[model samples]
Target: MNMLEVFVSSLEEFQPDLVVLSGLHMMEGQTKEMRQKRLLEAVASISDIPMGVPVHLELASMTDPELMSAIIHQQVFPLVNSVGLNEQELLFLTQAASGPHASLASWNGVPDVGVVSDIVFWILKEHGRTPGKASDLTRIHFHTLAYHLLVTVDGYWANQVAAVAAGARVAGTQACATQTIDASRVFLKAPLEFATSKMEEASTVSLNPHEPVSEWHRDGVTFHYTPVLVCKDPLRTVGLGDAISAEGLLYSEIYPH
Candidate 1:
């Protein structure tokens, strides 16, 4: 906690292009009062980030609804420009926020793209960047075994196709524990055709292998989807989400640059 406070206080000296916060779930065992104090400090430090320098919050498995709610409603979520999470974290956020499909306890398999898309859309519309609001969130990079979804407010982000593809590619290499992908071991598991949302009138998007990346626009947001080359035999699954998020961010281009 002391180290974090010192680093955050020195942001002007570092002048970073991006800031990412992860592993808050590490505080699970702390007493409520202690956790509250640290979180309050964290929120205060994050608020000190200079305007226009994008921040990304990466979420992990957190079972406590109270902690999740505090991060979502009171402080953290409102200040970050982007977020990265898997299906479980996404469902938990929806559940905590009382948003769409809040009743689902867990997913049976790779979640349906439409359901994921709907939830991602709901998050941005309900909690993300809005006129006169403090929330700066405009981008969500959601990863699953089957696919990766990069959703962003249209004007704030650019080059979605490359970013999504880079994330999907890293999932294979990282899981297989190889710097270069082994073609015989990796196979695509994502659906070729998927609906944009769960709505009755939602549009269906079909993947073209030649292009691989499929994109759609809804309301004021744009979604980019790419099928992951899943590893048939995995050496390790740990850190896959982090690797995916990091690679995606590396390729991501902030608009108006």
Candidate 2:
């Protein structure tokens, strides 16, 4: 807290619209005592942000169970308005909280859409803002090799389909290091026809190749899903999550004025 006091004290002058925090994993190197102390500071720093300024927490690969537990159980998850994560980070979060689909060690290939939907639904219902909850979380931008999912409360976010497609498009362009996409060099990994919806058993969502974004609603939340154009031979695998999240955020329109 002391180290960042100077920056934390200056939020009013800058008055930024969005705040993204990505390096909490950098604190994992210290001893448990020191790490716990820093986690406290982190909570204080994030909680001090001015009201209505959306904060997005970008998570990375973290293996320490204790550190993961602290983040999930503390004010960190409650304070942030949005979160961006890959499959590994998403699974780690569910595992930490012992939420839905927590028993699987890992996925063999691209995770099933129904399963992913179920877990994402669980996250919002339990931890996110809803009718009675006091938490700030209202959106989650989840990405994987095959597809991207943007799940948010209806009123807080607009432009759902465009935001999701932007994320998918950037995944290919960034991975291939090209501004223009070459069709032959990329392939679709998500199902072209349809995907099962676990939110309601025996139901599925259809994907249109011409317009790939699939949308559905359940339990007062809306879902947007889009297939990714995966690079056949990728030059870079690192930082793709950040690219996807940033692209989606750029297209997303916040409803609040």
Candidate 3:
């Protein structure tokens, strides 16, 4: 889109904490499908460091959800350790007595709107053996939602909630603003723990430490990229430089796309 060059060039400049790659709908000349694919490739290819360029696609309508989920599972999640969602956002779509799917069935053509965080609390309360157990059913519903060809607005929120709940956390790992559940935060420890548990239950192959550093080949860009990801700021950069530096720069990338 018009901002791509601006954004990409900025990546070469500010090199901020994390780079999220949404924004393809703004491009004027291409079809939506083409734009999404091009954006996906550019984002995925940004790595010069071993496993450093993990890409995240927001759970948006524009992409093929199954393929996107497959990509996230295969190319991004292992490299990343977190995905955050606001509790209110989840409540907007799902709730105790009904989810968007049920609403659609009832409506036949029109859809009902619900509060995200509010509904999340009710859904968890109703489905779980206990509050803590609710996220499990939420996660199942999410994984299934990702595979659906058509999505209800509620379904979209459900997938996001489920996917993240599947290993997702509250933004910055604090208590849900209204619900009081331990929200997934910006922290790595909780997400890592959740991911490990999910794999164990599903018997899926777990992500291994990324390929060795020396295996990567750089093509003359000066920015340093490392094997693992974590958010970075000026202070963190100083700490990183102390521990790992190449060509006079300390480098780390955040994997949450």
Candidate 4:
């Protein structure tokens, strides 16, 4: 079987409560605002799934405080109840909302294309240039190091509540299009109690903008859907399909039944 068949089978059988559009692993965007907008719109368009629920996402960036806030205000506020960010991300988020890069990037020698929250902090401390309470973006249920937290299906994240526990914290079985994390961000394993006995057919994999992948595979199978998952041969990149085999069979005690 192929990777597409595997993922589709999983989705068809599990029927997860919510879906997470795994950002393809790459980062060369215009800005956080633009990227946030694209991400939000894409997630809003998934066909079969509940729209209202908290979602867990894995990220890796250098410093993009404003960009992160853009995601919160533009996409999350309405669709998501809360979000999860690492300590550094939280710091930048506070600064970015206020129009200052916040410089949260240098907190741990980690630098990327993210905003700097400290810029706002310094400005507020010294210049006081903030026109108004531009930094009143604290209306969120933020969790630190959510990546680490999601590594296990313990009681802390037993319910898949995005950043908290409620009920539906389910993630789509699709591969992330442009997912970049400072470290590894893996969703905990749910024993494969439920399995797709057999796949019927392979579906075409279509990736939206701002989405890229490193390796697309399924159950140890590699996907090769040209023009859909990868770049030109010389400038090749992988899609979510390559992350697993077409038949992503696993030995989990509890499947998504």
Instruction: Report the number of the highest-TM-score candidate.
Output: 1
lDDT of 2: 0.85
Query: What TM-score would candidate 3 get against the native?
Result: 0.27
Q: Write the per-residue lDDT of candidate 2 for residues 68-182, one digit (tens) a residue.
A: 8788677788888888988998888788878878997997788888778778888888888888888888899999999999999778898989999999999999899889777
Instruction: Provide the TM-score for each candidate, comma-separated.
Output: 0.95, 0.94, 0.27, 0.33
* Alpha-carbon lDDT, every model: 0.88, 0.85, 0.27, 0.30
- Candidate order by decreasing TM-score: 1, 2, 4, 3
Candidate 4 on 1-257: residue-level lDDT in tens?
13323453477466654433334223225555666555555435432233332233333343555556555455433342223334455465556565344433445432211222222123222222123432211112222211111112111122222222210111122232223311133332221122111122333333322322111223312221111121111122233222221111111111121
Runs with alpha carbons beyond 4 Å of true place in candidate 1? none
Q: For residues 83-116, could you state the per-residue lDDT of candidate 3 as single tens digits?
A: 2222222322333223533232222221111122
Candidate 2 residue-pair clash tally: 0
- Per-prediction CA RMSD (Å): 1.5, 1.7, 18.0, 18.9
Task: Name the 10 consecutive residues with the lowest summed lDDT in model 4.
Answer: 245-254
lDDT of 1 by residue, 1-257 (tens): 67767878788898988888886787778999999998888888888878778889899999998888888887788888899999999999889888888888899777989889889998888788866666788999999999999999878888788999999998999889888888999998888888888854799888898998888888998999999999999998988898899999999988642
Number of the candidate with higher TM-score, 1 or 4: 1
Candidate 4: regions farther than 4 A off? 1-13, 18-37, 46-48, 51-54, 99-257
Higher-lDDT candidate of 3 and 4: 4
